[model samples]
Target: MTISAELLPQHVAIIMDGNNRFAKKKHLQKGDGHREGKNVLDPIVEHCRKVGVKALTVYAFSSENWNRPQYEVDLLMKLLEETINEQIPRMIKFQIGLRFIGDRSRLTPELQQLMLQAEQRTATFTEMTLTIAVSYGGMWDIAQTAKTIAQLVKEQKIDVDQVDVDLFAQHVSLGDLPPVDLLIRTGGDYRLSNFLLWQSAYAELYFTETLWPEFTTEELDHAFGVFLGRERRFGKTSEQVQQEKIEN
Candidate 1:
């Protein structure tokens, strides 16, 4: 199907799930599913860029994921480091900025340093930004932002009354990027699962039964189509929205 560039999402976020399930279903060795899922992202990233998506943020590891078995957690962390190292060159080639949002204090010193280096190296790229959220959670993101805002207020850098949505927004992750326009989950889950709470406030949601390892660009296209067909009134009435569209 042909997609109209006019209505394409400015930013897209993905909740990649079902790697372990896919592994079990395929009878693959313990951690192969995660590896399979990891490979699926490259094409999707390229597809998003080709379709004019300005940014893509993916849920790589969540704060709660630390509760998983130690071996699995270790494997995931190793994969994340590998992913960053592998993506740096591609990011430069594609002119995409690479970023990370998470509690870095929990990560090893080497990984933290590598993440910072990657962010700084690709800081100026304009083609698109690819954000990987490792050791991240929506509540953690909001709580940290609130803490920062409170500190500023205490320091007299910001007035107590100056705290508002706009002021609070700049302190959150992805604050400088366009708000997430579409959020997709590929594990048949219907919940946000503690990811990108503040940034995806009004994003169109797409859920699919296909596991992360099996999700495809064609599926991504279908999600965009659904987003295009929806009426995102943002609290405006249907009549008012239609009238505004006609005037535009």
Candidate 2:
């Protein structure tokens, strides 16, 4: 329930993978795997909030996911909509803000409406924030930020030379939140898969063989343990980091 402040990750990101594989491995119906994965998030969210993480971001859908089989895509969309509907009250119950960061144009109008309303309903919760990346990709998020910066340049709001990391960062999705301190990928993947590329520039990465549906609070704890056991030096040498820690 409680963790050391120095070891706690203010922001955590999860690449929830292996739903279809879980289905095949379990001999379940075609879409049941996704449904099972969907059910796994609530407790994780609660646990994150309980452990003092300010923000939790999950990869729900990606821009590239549109290429999946139409039926599978449809199932994902339905599940997303259901997730929004189901999470709004839970968000309020836990005093957590719910947010969605991604391209909304590709979503159904009805689903978009639901997402907007859910965001509105939970906008005031300040204890923690849950961000679902739907139709989201790191490349897309950065491109959108670039486009906004270019538009501002065109409007002469600021000089083009003024565009820097800080300026560009402010325009990126979830820029107001803490940078990702821990990124967890389930299902044995060792790659980022284009999720939160910029936000997780210095995050501690945790990979696990457990499928998403099987990922639990215990797994999260293990990831935190791994994070604490390692050292994040940023660009500093080990000696410098250790000296700084001693000074603090």
Candidate 3:
């Protein structure tokens, strides 16, 4: 399935899930699913770029992921390091800028170094942006942004009354990217799972039973179709929304 030109989202975010469960179902080791999922990331990201998406944000790892077994976490970090090392050239070839969002403190020095290298290598690309959220949480993002805003106010950089939505957003991760127009979750999930709370306030959401390792371009096209059918009011009445112009 191909996304219709009229229905594609400029900015799409995804919560990639069910790797461990999928591996268990297949009688594979816990980390095997993650490896398979990682293999799929490059293809899906390229698909998004080809389909005219301006930005893509993927929830690779959450802050709560640290609660998992130490072995799993270690394996995941290693997988992350390898993914970055292998994918940087691909990102550059696709003209896709890379950005990392989330707490980097938990990552090992080597992994952190790889992340920086990936971002720097792809910084000049402008066709699209791919953000990998590692050790991320929606509430955590908001709390951190709030703390930054408070500190700014204390320094008299801005007044307390000046802290509005736009100002708050400036401090959040990937604030330079446009608002997320669509949010999808794979693995039969139906929740946000602490991914992008403030950014996805009005994003159209799509849930599918396909696991992260199995999500394909066709699945993404179907999700776009579903997104097209909805009326995005953005807190306005239907009558008010229809009167406005939305670019395809």
For each candidate, what TM-score against the reference?
Answer: 0.98, 0.98, 0.95
Q: What are the per-residue Cα lDDT tens digits for candidate 1 across 1-248?
A: 66766689999999999999999999999999999999999999999998889999999999999999999999999999999999999999999999999999999999999999999999999999999999999999999999999999999998999999999899999899999999999988899999999999999999999999999999999999999999999999999999999999
The order of the candidates by lDDT, greatest first, is 1, 2, 3
Look at candidate 3 and give me any clashing residue pairs.
none
Clashes of each: 0, 0, 0
Runs with alpha carbons beyond 4 Å of true place in candidate 3: 1-6, 245-248
C-alpha RMSD of each candidate structure in angstroms: 0.8, 0.9, 1.8
Model 2 per-residue lDDT tens digits across residues 1-248: 45875569999999999999999999999999999999999999999988888999999999899999999999999999889889988998999999999999999899989998988998888999999999999999999999999999999998989999999889999999989999999999799988999999999999999999999998899888888888899999999999998999
Model 2 spans with C-alpha error above 4 angstroms: none
lDDT of 3 at 57: 96
Better of 1 and 3 by TM-score: 1
Q: Specify the poorest-scoring 10-residue window by lDDT in model 3.
A: 239-248
lDDT of each: 0.95, 0.94, 0.89
